[model samples]
Target: MRFWLLCGAALAGTMVADTASADTLREALLQAYNVNPTLTGARARQRAIDEGVPIAKAEARPLVDSDVTFQQNYRGISPFQDNGRSISAGATASYPIYAGGRIKNSIRAADTRVSAGQADLLATEGAVFTETVAAYMDVIRDVSIVELNQNQVKVLETNLQASRDRFDVGDLTRTDVAQSEARLSDARSRLTVAESTLTTSRENYRRLVGLLPGMLEPPPPLPTLPQTPNEAVRIALDNNANLKASEENAKAAGYDVRTARASRLPSLSASTGVSYTDYLGTLDNVTGSAAGLNPKDAFTDSFFGLRARMPLYQGGGPAARIRQAQALQGQALEQVIEVERLVIADARSAFGRYMAALETIESSQQAVAANRLALEGTRAENSVGTRNVLDVLNAEQELLNSQVLLVTARREAYVAGFALLNAMGQAEMRDLGLDGGTLYDPIVNYKRVRNKAWDWSDDPAPTTQATRTATPEEDPRAQGPVTPPSN
Candidate 1:
């Protein structure tokens, strides 16, 4: 009896260790947000767009430039003279008084493009979040499968031992013993496959999150879905990033048209410049007398001028540009329409998948319950000699399969919920109820770094520690012999 108690305690300890070693889903998600390459690339692209704001604002500011000219003139009259040497220096300042409405429209277009860039970054982030959640869930499901299969193998091993004992006593036939062994072998094979699958799933999760896989706490329960697909479609159409980007694009295209049309109007500007030159030379008259020129022969000139340029005729160039801009505007409008259609389709598909996953969860739960009962009954019949060991093995296999299916169904349901949120462009970390208190915010960190919030520029680079580094247990490329399973 003490031996049995010790075994029970050992089993419980193993279970506790396994649970403690697992990483939670939220931790995996945070890691993924921090290290995901796709997201990092998108953020860099957005910063590039942010620079456009300063560039566009620069257009309305004044421009200043200077030029210097050195010239040696030979009049063929004085080869021995300085030959009217002159050094000219000039500076000019100009400011755009007006370009009709072209400059303003162009700036507005740039602003809208910045908005589109932001939307694109958000969309990419949403995509990465969705994928990370899916992969994390996959690892969870695979781990559960491995656990279930391990349990099944344990039960089969126990049954096989019982069958062998009974066969030695002539209470069970050789056939029964053979059947029990076959079931145990099959269970062992399944356990091996489950372990392999769990390893692969862990690697996938690690790749996305840049960390080792750990025990995952089950996600919180989801809210009920919308009652109608139309409701979902409406929400998505209003909030989808792709749709928002398209709308911004259309606005930018309209601004382009404005810019093109403004080209036909007059542009006004003001300019000022100052110039100085010194000329030293001797002029020879036709009477052959040499005359010395005054050093003050060079004078400084300063001028300020206002000018207006009106487009007259360009041989159809202005009209052609206007027509091209109009065409592009039309194309943008059509793109908006196309995006609307796609948004609706995506909403419908996600809603359907969510509903299907829900149904599967229900059916799978029922199957698990039914299979458990069937296996229990088969074991009782076998004890009474009314059923053979093969019947029991078959029932056990069915139960194991049903448990795996149920785990998969639950995972699918969770993923489907997130997918619906993604389709609606509402799958942010905050929406997942994972906000507040050290939650990793990519945008916040990006802004902090970009705006120099922390003064990290002054920090020294980190040095490696002298402590020993730990090696991961599950290396896919290792070629050593496989270890036998612990009983």
Candidate 2:
């Protein structure tokens, strides 16, 4: 019974461990979208922009103000009798009847500003995604190199042992034993460097994603390539967030010019007010009788008025403002054009990189296969005394180098694919198939929180899913292990 209970407990523990270890690349990306400081800061800036919308809209609404005063006097006043104490309260309301479209133009400018802010947020997200993908690829490449070096060390050690045995039997020269030992030492040194590099890459990945790197899973397979460079460029031009932001800024500048032009026109407004006053102590009336009034028994008076004002001249102020706005509009227009050109260029560059990476992967795969065959042949020849130990060691190193190159090329290809997606502004969490519903959509969350529609009191507890899973058949290095290799 004791043995059975222990076995059952061990099995449960193993299952819990497996569950904890299971994660996917998509999950990592969703977590990053939620917790990345860059994304959060961008969203905060966007909310600040939304606040401008209400400020602009308030211009068309009525304005109200109130004033109250209380005074106490000990000495008598000669003019109209004496007031020991007095209290007065007044309120005023004003409404703009007309402003020569200045309010409308200002509101339009504010709207444009809000749009620009949204675009800016999107642009920031694109940049963050690009950096994350690059860091992820670096981790994968470095880990793969470390693994390759470790395998190389093992191969060299085996060769050194064989050489020592052969020398003991007088079948190999002392020079061959020395060469095998030297190769083994070189392999160990390379392994150490590779392990250190892998550690640094893992830390960078962890920092970007806001999680421990070991918890992340391998990224999804690369998508199919775009058929033509023009197609890719068109996609980038149409969808690139930075390009959109530039266009929005240009539109906002145009609105600013309109606002400046409108400021030169006339403004009209209407206002009305009512007030009550009371003498809290004794006051002498015209009949010489003392009249006492309390704040509760105040006399009421009412009046209404309309106001009109026009901007005639202010030292060329309006004209200067208009000119400044016009200059800014022109600068914004130029920026839009520049962004379009840049987006197209980025698309072209990413497409070229993807193509080059594809070619490299193909070439490296071939090289790895060829080098493996050569290493095998050299080992066989050394065993039969036809090839020296140095030949085996050199062949093993070549094979290891080829494997490292192949892994690096594959990772580069994957990264370039992501780069192309980002250049086209299509590299969202959803596009990466990381749409775990936990993926942060700033716009949606902003609307919910800003509108006071989110129920903070009843909010659900935050939950997270594992972002990776281990497969028994898959090598840790191939999937990009986050742990540093043991030297």
Candidate 3:
């Protein structure tokens, strides 16, 4: 007989009669990557941050504005009054020539923050992917547990019927029957709990993967693991997305300080514009036949000049801004060190847990083997009247316990391994080798909008990007595995 009952593939589809197809771990990760709401929102927020670069650059670009005005006056108050009707139109244009590095520094700060935002987006991806892995494995683990408990219930049922038969034949006592009945009842209760846990896990899977999971293939082995915990920590300090984001934030803050200081310096700009006004015969002083002026005659005004603004005093506002930026820059620098500490701690802890879980799995496998042998021996002795029914019953229970422990340990090992990878910054989409579609590149958006100048250009209206967990599979039991899954 097989050492343990293996979890089988689920039905091909949710429908009762559909062909069978199994869901792999890769598929779940891909689904979450494409449409998980949290990750999608992070990407959207990063895109918004990218716009800041262009917004900062715009401060130095030419600004053009135009205006038109129509007026009517009944009272003539000298040559300046246009009583009948008059229209005015004018346009103004200005370009910043210099700002003591304020514009340049501001753009640098925004671009650095964009880098920080991209790092934040990467962290979000890693976080969401980590959760998806946990959720996916949870369903698999719970399903295996439910199946094991179900098998236990069956075994107890067989024991109970045998106990009653033996008692009726005067070979076993009524206490033996009672004991079997009690154990069977307990196994059934445990089975209920296991199935309930399985249901909860399936709901979580649906939340992340956009549907209830079917049979899930075993996850592939983790790659590029560091040989030592110290190595893992070193890698994490260098590559952890959270830490990188903090460092980028610190760099951005430094740029902000420079930008603030530049504010106190004088700024120069060029201004050029044209203005026109039509009297429309309303200026009677200039529109009459005696005046020798045409009703259509208009005023044309043109000007070009350089503007220089030097701040002598501003109520200490610019100084305050500079000080505030300096303070924030220090805070950002401290945050980088703090994040580095956390990354180091996480890398070491995850590595320890993975190692411990692997050891547990090995030990539990041995226990399961020993217990199975013990139960077999106890049955043989009971058949020959050398051992009591209680002894056989105890052996069977021990084997079931060991089987459950082994399954749990296997689950723990896989999860811990994945967690270790995540802590070491090796679990994002690029490392996942997903062929589902093109990976999202934040640079695509940054490049698209960093120099955007069209005032009317805009993206399509935003819609709900994530799939709703509508009508999720209510009963996970119906999709129970039928054969062992391939890793």
lDDT of each: 0.74, 0.73, 0.82
- lDDT of candidate 1 over 1-487, digit per residue (tens): 0111121121111122254565665666666665676776776676666555445556666778889897766647776644556677899999898988887887788778778877777777678878888887788788778888888889988998999999999999999899888888988898899999989887777667776677775554555556678998988887888889889989999999998888899999999999986553422322234564333446699999999999898788878999999999899999999988988998898888888887987887788889889999998998998988899888988887777777887778778777777778786554555432564434453343333322235335643322212244656435566788999
* Candidate 1 Cα outliers beyond 4 Å, as residue runs: 1-22, 73-84, 161-186, 279-291, 313-316, 430-433, 436-487
TM-score result, candidate 3? 0.88
Ten consecutive residues with minimal summed lDDT in candidate 2? Answer: 7-16
- In model 1, state the lDDT of residue 24: 60
Q: What's the candidate order when arranged by decreasing lDDT?
A: 3, 1, 2
* Pick by lDDT: 2 or 3, better one: 3
Q: Give the alpha carbon lDDT tens digit for every residue of 231-345 in model 3.
A: 9998787778899899999999999999998889999999999999987755654344455455456799999999999999999999999999999999999999899988888
Pick out the ten consecutive residues of candidate 1 with the lowest summed lDDT: 1-10
Model 3 residue 67 lDDT score: 100
Error of 3 at 397 (Å): 2.0
Candidate 3: RMSD to truth: 8.6
lDDT of 1 at 17: 27
